[model samples]
Target: MEVSMFGGLVLVMVLVVVVVPALLVGLVLWLVSRSTSDDGGAPARAARRHELLVSSVAVLAAVVCTVVLLAQPVAWPGWASAPGVLQAITPFSVALVLCVVRAVGEQTWPRPRGEVRSAPLARRTIWSLGGARLRIVLVTAAALAVALVVFGATADPTGRAFATNPVTLPDGSVVSGASGPYPGWPYGLPMLLGLALAVAATFVALGSITRRPPLHGVPARHDDAVRATSAARLLGAVQLCLGVGLGGALAVGGAAIQSRGQNLLLDELPTHGLVAVGGGVALLGIAVVVASGIAGLLAAWPRAARHAGAPAATGAPA
Candidate 1:
């Protein structure tokens, strides 16, 4: 459905970006908490409560965003049109179900209280919420990057040029602009780049789960880290699907513009602008993912670096 510029922005920010991660993170946390909370102890109960809270917040946010998305009309033509309110209903329902599973699971999981082995960086990263939710944040950030890239690649460039059904435009109008999914070389570049970013994120999530290189702070041998990474990978895969799939749709717009005898008036700068904006969004995603991955990797490696700095057991202390 074609959505207006403002409508597009809201849909991208709320549905694709915010709601998806919230659902994923809340669900994962709830599941993990449930698995560990076997003893009807205070901690287990508390964890369940926290899970409920996260689920509630996520559901609330998704609902609000969906309402906003449906209420708003898309200003642009093919690129931006008001979507059916029902469009968001399915995802919302899915998110709600995930929340329910997590909340229920939290009540029955085994709870063990051993000395929490500290990861120096993980400690610092989530001093407020703790390490359990750190992976959630990472996954959410990655998803955000994915959405931003998708936005840049698919956004209507030449403003309202695409709004009026092109077939209805005056005769002899040289329509040389692109439209929905897989527009041209312009959109292809972002699609590929965004796809690459999503793949890289998947690799990083895997490494984090396995506690591989760059995930040093993530407790390489810890079960929690593994579980967290698994959740993160799932989220990343979703992000990849959305980014690549949306990009393909945008590229189609470019393909439509391939008519040789179409009106050149359609060759306005706004069309190029929309393409550029979309590309820029993908570029931003690339930057964010690369930077975050580097930061995470560095943070994860501090312990090894410290050990490397130390003298051997047989050597005298510095």
Candidate 2:
């Protein structure tokens, strides 16, 4: 079955519009049910209230994205395709930005599971390779390198499509049937930029999450909770952004191929299967965002439960 670029765009529309709302609804309902089951007579606390507000915002964004997505494919005179992607990304992007900002003000390091006082992880934190910090950096760098290979270095040099150039048929006639695009010195630069930005964001977020207090004693349980939430939320944001950047590059690249093909009046475009690849990336990113959010919340719910019952922190006199 031959799928066109337009068809893939609509499929992405369904992903962002239909699937997002369904996921949000299911998540909200699940949280409500879990809370009710856990504490049948308890009143909602500040954390629960905050989560509901965030859910409401997410649902609102999903509805707006639905309208924009539905309008995009039809090119409803006033609705432009470019805005569809931007709109879909805005809510997620904003949420992530808030996460990072909040991280900025977080405690320099976590307290021991049982101790009350807090201090820095070390005299100078930069050289500390302990925990997930170095791992996050290495993984992010590896991911960027892979993206560069797949999207940039391998791009077709002729600037027509990725890894494609003109070919001579048996009839001795030349055709632009190359499977890739023409490349240039600056080719695929935007993809690299997008990847770099995502990597940078991931690094900063991971650094904040991995600042552990000296680890001896019962503090380990709380440390595990911190790491679980951090991994879920930070990794989710990273993957979401990475997926968007890669998917956007593929979509734009596919459009370029269609344009070149039409201009050349070719029967087939250079990048025949590009749309499917882009759609897949978009879906992966959407899945990561939803999954990570749920995981982060679940990881922290127990911590919140403990906090709800424990006495408030009070500093002892020197």
Candidate 3:
């Protein structure tokens, strides 16, 4: 009871002190990203700088991890077995994960100052009330249906009790029972689908922001840029979400498969066998997302940099 109590306290503390702050910060940045244009201000410049920093950090971490592994080989769960070596390399893994997350957040970086000013920065209209909500409902319902089907279908025929205590294998190369007794597919499919729904909702929300009819009292050039920005932002966000979902599926699903290996042959599992395919999907998503963001910025570039680009008049139809 005491151990459980202590664990609960630790979890609560972690959530309050770490997770909540991270989430809040992410939310702020996301809103800012959607609102701010790439006009070389401190925020825009910072956004540009962040991309380089993340990429450089990722590459540097990979190189360092490779060097460390070569210097002192360790088992797969090195953190548990050879803590000293893994401790050094863990930073790199963490940095890589952070870089991936940051890239996803940055996918919402806005277009040119001129285009964004003409549009409503934080306004909602019929599109959000009608189209976006409809999209969300349809997508979420479909995902839930699919999740239920997969969950029920993947149930173990023999009803094997899941291992409560995970242990390292004798070979020390793999660990099993890192997850619950449920089949990997049952758990992973739902998670992947949930992530997908969130992505789809975000795309729809961004689309609603671009609901500027042709008669919107803005210049044609600015209107076109606004539409382009909306498309670019939505595409970038979609790619980011897809990549993250695929990556999460592979990681969690692979771990679950390995956990079940005491009874099941994970090597023969299609999900485990097709890791290369999963990686390709993730990489493709990341590439497309990053490309869209960069392209959006370039496309929104105005001929004049110092110009305070806004709508011709206040209260214009955004």
Q: Which candidate leads the pack in TM-score?
A: 2
Tens digit per residue, CA lDDT, model 2, 237-279: 3443344433444444444444444544454434455455544
Off by over 4 Å in 2: 1-26, 29-101, 104-116, 119-141, 156-160, 178-187, 209-227, 247-318
Candidate 2: C-alpha RMSD after superposition:
8.9
For residue 67, model 3's alpha carbon misses the true position, in angstroms, by 31
lDDT of 1 by residue, 1-318 (tens): 433432353356445444564455556555655565433245324433543454345345545644553554433235322232223222333233333333343334333343433333332121221243335444553553454354344445632123323442355554334343323233334333544454444334333333212221222223232233333333433333343244323333333332211333344323434445445544554444344333322222101112333322111111
Q: How well does each candidate superpose onto the true structure, as a TM-score?
A: 0.32, 0.48, 0.33
Model 3 lDDT per residue over 1-318, tens place: 322332233234323322343344345445655565664445434433343343334333433443443334223352222212232223223323433443443444343332234554444443442343335334433443453344335445422112322345656655433232332333334344444455445444444444534222434334334344333333333333233233232332333334554333453422333345334533543453344334323322222222345432212333
**1 versus 2: better lDDT goes to:** 2
Clashes of 2: 15
* C-alpha lDDT of candidate 3 relative to the true structure: 0.36
Off by over 4 Å in 3: 1-152, 155-200, 213-218, 262-318
Worst 10 residues of 3 by lDDT: 79-88
* lDDT agreement with native, every candidate: 0.36, 0.41, 0.36
